[model samples]
Target: MTRPPEPPPKRHGVLRLWHALRYSWDGLRAGWREPALRQELVLGAVLLPAAWWVGRDAVHVALLALSVVAVWVVELLNTAVESVVDRIGPEWHPLAKRAKDMGSAAVLLTLLASGGLWAWSLWAWWRG
Candidate 1:
């Protein structure tokens, strides 16, 4: 006779939260392990507060925070791509280099956007 299928596992609310926290911690640790991430984090910490100080309005503060978050988010994604690419082929393949370059370009775009936002905010604050 064929065995019956097992029931699906049930997750408690606390268990779900714990799992999420665990994953977040893992991601944080991974970021810490990467030199590039550390550099970005340091830069974000410096620029974000400076932006807030220059703007000094609630809306400006929020926008600055969002920009900083965007930079960190992109860097994390780029790191993930680099990690996966390296895992797939540790050798210096042209494709692997291209993948890494694309990730870097994405980060550059984010930085440019952040810079533009800061410039506009500063200009507006000075004018008004």
Candidate 2:
């Protein structure tokens, strides 16, 4: 037998926007509660204003800010992956370990990129 059609998605407008914002805030709060996420957030808080000061122009500022944000984004994704893996079970499975390790590697790479970008901007500012 054929399955019934799925219901249409809810309409998009002001109410939807509000819900999206609320959900985003909830996620931020959840991230903040996590120790590693909290530390990264504090680091971002410090680096953001410093970026404004160190950047020579809007482009430079954007680059620096985006890099920092990218790291945070990757970290959040990594956290999500780890959470899911842990939820599945506490067993020492190879696939689970691999997934967590890959997520961690992603976060590490993002951090390295952010650091490199900031360094490049600082070097340019110092030279000019």
Each prediction's whole-model lDDT (CA): 0.87, 0.90
- Model 1 regions lying over 4 Å from their true place: 1-12, 126-128
**Can you tell me which runs of candidate 2 are displaced by over 4 Å?**
1-12
Candidate 2 clashes between residue pairs 3 or more apart in a chain or in different chains: none
Highest TM-score: give the candidate number.
2
For candidate 1, list the clashing residue pairs, or say none. none
Pick the lDDT winner: 2
lDDT of 2 by residue, 1-128 (tens): 99999965685899889888888898888788888888888999999999999998899899999998998898888988998999999989999999999999998999899999988888988988
Clash number for each model: 0, 0
Tens-digit lDDT string for candidate 1 (4-59): 99964667799978887888999989988888779888988888788767776788
RMSD of each: 5.8, 4.8
